[model samples]
Target: SRSLFVKNLNFRTSDENLKKHFTEKLNEGRVQSAKVKKHLKNGKNVSMGFGFIELDSVETATKVCKDLQGTILDGHALILQHCHAKSDDKVSNRADKDKSSTKLIVRNVAFEATEKDLRQLFSPFGQVKSLRLPMKLGNHRGFAFVEFVTKQEAQNALQQLSSVHLYGRHLVLERAKEGETLEDLRARTAAQFTDEQNGYQNSTKLAKKRKHMDILDKPDVMFEKIAR
Candidate 1:
């Protein structure tokens, strides 16, 4: 295969680590080299969050790209595209990029479940970026947000969890909801603390969305909330 430019590598990663990771992805190639170039101004290393791999031929490279483009590696998307130039940076596509909004909403949880328990359940599907269980002081609300490394994995989790009962109750799983970006997830937690102190609820939409998603208005007890 023609030489490729693998950019966006982890700043702390070395050629050997990249080779091992690529070897796992290709499974047929010997990644000859995986070098991390130094920044020019102060010689500081910057993780461009990308990298390259050399295969025996163009056919192998194409096959590799086809297999791993949307996969997740090292808690980030393993972007595999034809290399154009050398520099470590992210992909130009929005779908391939991870922004502040990609996260999963896990509801109808057992009141006894802990943060560790939630992580253990979903970690098998993919790298969990974060697993947060809503707790007020020492109270468990039976709701959580388990953020997977990729959106596809999050969807997979929802499919597997829907209609499935844990602790004798059907678990509610779906996309966390719009307007609930990753940045504001924790913001609500902080705001909730203040609101609790002042004896009021935060104005964030998640609390209300959670209420609606649980289908609290439905009259039947046997009904399940379906994700759109």
Candidate 2:
């Protein structure tokens, strides 16, 4: 299942040229197919450096990536990866070709449910840390993803929620759409924390200094001003 994308390829390079390059470097007929993307603009075709190469197997793909990534190809380093699609969804919520979120799905709920409600219901089985409740036109769809503190919690919820009933509706919980890992969650949390910290550090220093002065009674009228 290792489909690779080669970036920074020569614009004029054809599938035959690319196949020859791979054959020289790897082995005979290792490449299944290779094609550069062409776009029609003003009735003229333009070649894009990016192209896909299907290898014989995942190991061969890895070998190609490890060997060719960062290697110079026509004045551009060849970047290779497992042909991940460009998506707006964060790494955790990536939508594959199927257009489904990588995160797990949770369904079958009472229309009045909230994230807090789901967490409470699932917390008994394990550490229910975070919950995302989906809404349509400002109405709860009766399903939510309860991210447990650990994968084991998620697995437990997958098993337990099927039998557990809340508000007369049986809860259905599954792994986050794409089986997102703890590292992805941590990275997201770290990014948010960095953003919040940067904003606070940049904008709050003067206000915080004024508040500190007021607390020390340096400006006695500051309290009155704040009260007013």
Candidate 3:
């Protein structure tokens, strides 16, 4: 069957309706079959407003596509393109290792995993200087880079925890590469503004400091408060 992938259909369009409508437009009995894509949501199959139209020949399919592409129905514009033909054989294949950072790249993390949880996972190896997860403007990419205080500690973590499962997915661990800087990683991944943007020199500067009216905006003013 020569099929055309279609999009932006009216939500209520059905399998028979799809074929019937296109068959009418083509003015021929060339439409062989039709299937509307559906979504399973909350125990119901919802129309996805897209589907496939199979024709008797590729020539007929192309003709219908050119004739009806962008035809509007219920204010939704239609998009039409040829569907990928199935090959006789079905096969599947799937496929990391890294470099000089006091850091390790951890992969296959669940989206819900957090920085604190990751810290606890490697804390026994050594003090983690910092941890960074690669993000696309605040979205988790399901991987992270952790910086131990020393390269030796990072190597240790890599040796021990490589291919281990955390949160039900096996992890791929390795030393981070040169390009993955902690500041840039965290700043880009963070949901809020970075410390530099807030006028602070860096995160370390405000990490911890005892406030004693010395916390006032004027840098030199002070009323030293002692712990009583």
Candidate 4:
């Protein structure tokens, strides 16, 4: 297939921008078609932060994926992969189901880490299907979920980034369990912290930690209070 999957694009990147990047800026080859995927939300067209590009030939697509894999466009690094042509509907449905297993839970992320930072870190393995960093009070919660296009890519990232440090913090990467949610992760983290504090003799410190956990437990209510 001459088509390529482009991921981690800036939301503002348009279809013309994608075509120009490959054909004009890089001068690599002719782009047959370029499209930044979008959908209508509340009657507004919103970019999905990903796109597809079809080149003149498979070789051109391969070269583009190899050479411009991490090219930054509009402040976000791009992840490129040679995408296979779509199969029949049944196979496509199966692929969609398989995607659930490709998500990774990234713990111990630096609070200062941005989506761009993580995209750059993981782009080498494969196409990043999607990424989410839960936020609170204008900053991330020190964790993220990154879903790759393939389970092998997710596994590779897990093995490679386990020892890597960002902003002076070691990242802990693991395959996300099926049907897991952000609330589940928060509860698990709280449980781990509580277990670590089990033998502590300082009742005052324990009480303070428990109070903090209580605040975290009601995130929506806390956010509402802040809004008011």
Against the reference, the lDDT scores of all candidates come to 0.58, 0.60, 0.65, 0.75
Error (Å) of candidate 4 at residue 152 is: 0.7
Q: Rank the candidates by lDDT, best first.
A: 4, 3, 2, 1
TM-score of 2: 0.37
Who wins the TM-score comparison?
Answer: 4
Q: Write the per-residue lDDT of candidate 1 for residues 1-228, one digit (tens) a residue.
A: 343444434446666776777677676755566654333223544443444566677767767667766555555555454542222333323314754334876667777556875675565445688888767679866667777665555655565445444444566775755567754665554565466646644445667887786676673642543431
Question: Each prediction's TM-score against the native?
Answer: 0.39, 0.37, 0.40, 0.43
| Clash pairs, model 4 backbone | none
For every candidate in turn, the CA RMSD to the true structure comes to 17.0, 16.7, 16.5, 13.4
| Full-model lDDT, candidate 4 | 0.75
lDDT of 2 by residue, 85-170 (tens): 22344432322232223334566767755666566555544555566765568986555555554444355446534554455455
Which residues of candidate 3, in runs, are more than 4 Å off? 85-228
Q: What tens-digit string does per-residue lDDT give for candidate 3 at 45-150? A: 7665667778999788878878888987557777876543222322111001222356666767777667876876666555688787666668777778787765
Top lDDT: which candidate number?
Answer: 4
Model 3, total clashes: 0
**Model 1 residue 200 lDDT?**
44
